[model samples]
Target: MRLTVLGCSGSVTGPDSPASGYLVTAPDAPPLVVDFGGGVLGALQRHANPNDVTVLLSHLHADHCLDVPGLLVWRRYGPEPAAERALLYGPEDAALRLGTASAEVGGECDDVSDTLEVRGWVDREPVKFGELSVTPFKVFHPPQSYGLRVVDSAGAVLAYSGDTGACSAVEELAQGADVFLCEASWTHDPGNRPVGVHLSGTEAGEVARRAGVGQLLLTHIPPWTSREDVLAEARAAFDGPVRAVNASESFDVVKSGSAVRRQTS
Candidate 1:
């Protein structure tokens, strides 16, 4: 299995980075995408056919999901016919939200929901899409959110903490994962507000350590927090290998004993 970081910024797109989006690939199936934030369409075009892609949304936050409409429109009107037939999966209301938003933007909504299959998330229940097995766990974000554990047929698992504060669901989703792609959207400073909505770098590292993940890929970093500081803080909490993932960075998973070797790609 291979994982690509399409974008890793938090809250909004940065000068050098886009918002949150990722792609997971396995040998037997098409690539799977997570969180199509703004600017991800170009990134998605690089590695796989968007028509064969399966999108898993973490939430409806603009930074996490605003690009769906544009992506759908591009697929529908682009020269590539296959791009218009991709499947989309997310929380129960994702299809409605995407369809409504696309129509609002004057895009085609004729069979958007039918073309995109959106299912309700059930904790611990595995949903299969081609060769990928995904398990979504409810998170602590408002309205609703989910942290996903994606496993390939080779037993390689990549767990993503969509966007949430410290929660048992996040830990469960990350348990024994080959790579933990967690969000570090806030600073470790005690004075920071919106306490339980996002994790700090230290908090993300702790989750990785506790989950016993093979590698830690810190993502969803806010613009204000220096990358150096976040990496330093995460290292202090996690003795294991922790790296800050950049946009377009990729990682390959190889079988190593019972664990998986998650090497940078």
Candidate 2:
């Protein structure tokens, strides 16, 4: 399985990158996209086909899921055939959140939702889409959020912590994962409260350390926060392989025994 970083910024689009979005692809199935943040459409255009993608939203935050209308427009007007539609999975209110935005863009919500099959998650239950199996666990975030563990048939697992604070649920989801795509939206200072919703770099690294993940890819950094600072903070806590993912970067996961090799691209 291959995991691609479509966007890796936090709160808003960074000067050099977009908000949070990722793509996970296996050999036999189409790519599964996680989050559809602000700049994800452009990233998808450069890396993959929007029509053949399946989106999994982490939450309804603008930075996490505001590009659905643009993607739908691209699928409708682009060279791709209308028959090619994306499958969308998210929280229970995903359709409502996206439908409202699509309507403002002069796009029909029903048509968009019909073209994209929307599935709502219930904690811990496994959902299947082709060869990919997704299990969602509740995370620490206001208004509800989820941390997803995606696994292929070969038992390769990639866990992603959607914008969330340090929580046991995230640790549970990330346990023994090949790659942990976690959010590091704040600095190292514990006293500096960042909206009380997101995790700092140290916290993210701690989660990775405790989960015993093969590799930790820190993401969701805000434009104001320097990448160097985040990396340094994470390194202080996690001795394992940890790096910050860039836009368009890809990580290949190879199943080896009980663990997997997470190769960066």
lDDT of each: 0.82, 0.84
Name the runs in model 2 displaced over 4 angstroms. 105-111, 194-196, 257-265
TM-score of decoy 1: 0.91
- Candidate 2 local lDDT, residue 216: 85
True-vs-predicted CA distance for residue 94, candidate 2, Å? 1.0
The whole-model C-alpha lDDT of candidate 2 against the native structure comes to: 0.84
Where model 1 places Cα greater than 4 Å from the true spot, the runs are 104-111, 257-265
Q: What TM-score fits each model?
A: 0.91, 0.91
Displacement of the residue 12 alpha carbon in candidate 1, Å = 0.7
